[model samples]
Target chain A: MSTIIPFGPQHPVLPEPLHLKITLKDEIVTDAIPMLGYVHRGLETLVSIKDLDQMVQVVERVCGICSCIHAHTYCMCVEGILGIEIPKRAEFLRIIWSELHRMHSHLLWLGLLADAFGMESLFMHCWRIRERVMDVMEATAGNRVIISINKVGGVRRDLSPDQLRWIAQVLDELERELDAIKPVLTNDYTVKKRTVGVGVLTKEQAYELGAVGPTLRGSGVAQDVRMTGYGAYKFIDFEPVVEKDGDSYARTMVRFRELYQAIDIVRQLIRKLPDGELSVKVKAAKPEGEIVCRSEQPRGELLYYVKGNGSKFLERVRIRTPTFANVPPLLAMLPGIEMADVPVVALSIDPCISCTER
Target chain B: MGFFTKLLETSRVKSPWIVHFDCGSCNGCDIEILACLTPIYDVERFGILNIGNPKHADILIVSGTVNHRNAKVLRNVYDQMPEPRAVIAIGACGTSGGIFREAYNVVGGVDKVIPVDVYVPGCPAKPEAIIDGVVLALGKLKEQRTAKDTDSLAAELHQAREFYANRADRQVVE
Candidate 1:
């Protein structure tokens, strides 16, 4: 006999509140349907009430884990609308912060994945190394974690030459730790047993369903928005990391490789950082235009559609988060997996429910 | 080690498996709790496991300010956990709704729905503070089980209800 088990909106394995209505024939998931819209905060509606400055804070709150990315996108959108040219130095700083966040976010996800597999020691190790990045963020920015350093036109804070040297030192230290983590994460038999071929999303399926970040990269798609050269990315040369396996291990590899790329991007920004004002002073005024801005968040590609109507407040703001785009791919991969692997599969895309619902 | 000594060690330190419950938080403390599990603090060395199921869990680590919509769900989760379960309320929002206290929808704190054994206390508390709070909860668990009768579950629930009712005025200032 087959049973339908509802996993989430309230369940243990889910890191986020994802309602997976799984049709199980014994222990295998024959069919899985995901139901979302739980954390939806009507951010689009709220955007109408907030001014451009306040909107930065509001948008930053969109995804707590990925707030820096959201804020950066919002700033980019607003800057595009106002036709204000940000300083070259500010652009470099943005790239540095964004990549730092990416490294930490991916490492954080890796730790959670380790924890989920019952690898307690590895979980601890990943988290311990992540703190070094957090310390770098704290020292440069007033706040340690959130690092609310992004503002309109450019960054709110500047990284001094001394600070740049400290950041370089930290990344170098992190590279050593990441080297140690790689063998345990990739070559370990236990991690291999849990992850390899656990969740399989084909290349065609990934494209059809619009998977983003490492999820798409894992499935052999070479799509990354950083390739578009937005902000300081044009100055910092790098390549979008890709893997063709389309399995849980592939997703893991994509994240691991991206961490290295993030480090490389930061190092390039530090070496090429121009000396100038970090933020361009913008007089508060209404923008009379509609602009669509897209930036790559840690999870995937995020699109922000902002409609301005000659007012300080935006007429309408629509943010299509990476998780929202990845949902279709998440559901497509679930039908053929064992019920126990559901959480690991869901997390492979780094499901950010807060971003999706908001 | 003798069986009695091993049993005593386990009892004194009921290494609780925590399952994170977010009634709806700003995600501040959620990340901080994750930080606690990371390498720097490594809450797992203390035998704390952040599990998924409420049935197998010995502790409920709830983040975020509770809202009217999720209050019933929070109570349901608390009810699902096995006996001698402890609730560690992490973050200012989880403890007293933090900045969201003034919001019309927020229910103020997790303790409004369930009895919280320890409050970590931060805008989103630091990772170190989260570790300390869990350690405190483990100690409190010893106090909870050694003296209380199994029949006091209903009574304890009643006390929690009364506390929540009185806690209405204790809401954080906007």
Candidate 2:
């Protein structure tokens, strides 16, 4: 006889309001089902009410952690529909901010992961470092969480040369701080004991379950939406980090490695920074097509589908957030595991319920 | 009241154990709440702990707009907290439903279900503002220092008696 238990929609460990139904006999899991829509804000349905210009702000709030990339994806989609190339400088600026968002998000996830695993000191240290990343974003984009920089044709804000230097200096300091924390994170006994060999998703399983981003990368799959070359990715070059073990530790390692890669990408974009217009004047003529756009968010690939009918209002706006795509694999990975490790396993994919529901 | 009860009241004010509940928030306000516990804002300096269980918590700090799915859960969590408790609504979304007010499923502000003690206004309610709101809840906890159980019970008894008296008056008029 299996006893089914409900785990969330509100739990202490993960910030997202995801509900997981775990079926268990004694203490071992039999199966798990996730019930989402707890935090669904219905932004996609608002496309009819909110015009194309005002929709950028709505899209950014889909998930605050990946807000920049959400706006970047929307801008890219809108830009695609309009068939106008954004200035090279704007693309560089977009990716610079996107990379900063990635670093901050990774550090945030690391801190939360530490907190979840009962490593309180490590959690505090990670958040302390994350503050510096938020500081850089706050100084440049005017807000720490949302950033609100991306627009349809270009971007809302531009960083000065002094701001660029400041960001590099701050990120370098963050890299050094990460250097200090890496050894303990990777080799710590408590972390490894809880994470190693836990929730293994093989490469084939990942693909079958539709896993994306670091979840797919952790399973030895080298597929990242960033490789598709959207935004400034067409200019900067970096390899998607991957680990073959496909367990919780491997996923953590993948994010940990990608944090450094994010810094490197920002540095490259800064070096290759171009001089051009901040934005192109957009025509009032409504776009008349359907377009699908994808960007690699901190969690994974965020896909946006926008349909237009030559009006200021869009026909439909749909978002396929990374966490939504990764939920299937989360279900596949939960069977026959110990009940104590449920939260850790659930968090491995970094479930963003609001993004998922929206 | 005995010395132990007084001591318990004092301790409750000294260290308010706050439980955070996210109804349908955008993760903005929820993260800001977590950020306050970090080294940057570090509300722990005031002896406040972010507890996991509601029964042990003296304050319920809720963020985000309430949708139909989470209204009962919010009330259930609010009910679990030991009284002489307070609720702080963080973010504009929680306070007034913000941008999600017109969403089909959302039930608007949290006040629609439970009484909110404090409302911290902002899109996400910055960590500084959230810290201020929590600190303010601490102040309320101290203000209601004497009413641990008996006073609230007495108030409820009075309301019940008043209901009967009003019914009797109505009968007389009929």
List TM-score (chain A only) for every prediction: 0.97, 0.98
Q: Estimate each model's TM-score.
A: 0.86, 0.94
Error of 2 at A52 (Å): 1.1
In Å, residue A284's CA in model 1 sits off its true spot by 2.5
Off by over 4 Å in 2: B1-5, B145-174
Candidate 2 per-residue lDDT, tens place, B1-174, comes to: 568777987888888898999888888888889999999899898899998889999999988889888898899999988878899998888999887787678889989999998999987788999888888988888777654467775787799999998896678553
How far is A168's C-alpha from truth in model 2 (Å)?
A: 0.7
Candidate 1 residue-wise lDDT, A276-358, digit = tens: 88777898767879899898988999999988898888888889999889988888888878888888888888888878876
lDDT of 2 by residue, A189-300 (tens): 9999989999999999999999999999999999988888877798878888999999999999999999999999999988899999999989784988999988899999
lDDT of candidate 1 at residue B159, scale 0 to 100: 94
Docking class of 1: acceptable
Residue B63 CA displacement from its true place in model 2, Å: 1.0
Query: Which stretches in model 1 have alpha-carbon errors above 4 Å?
Result: B1-17, B44-49, B55-59, B67-69, B82-88, B95-112, B115-123, B132-174
DockQ of 1: 0.24
**Against the hidden true structure, what lDDT does model 1 obtain?**
0.81
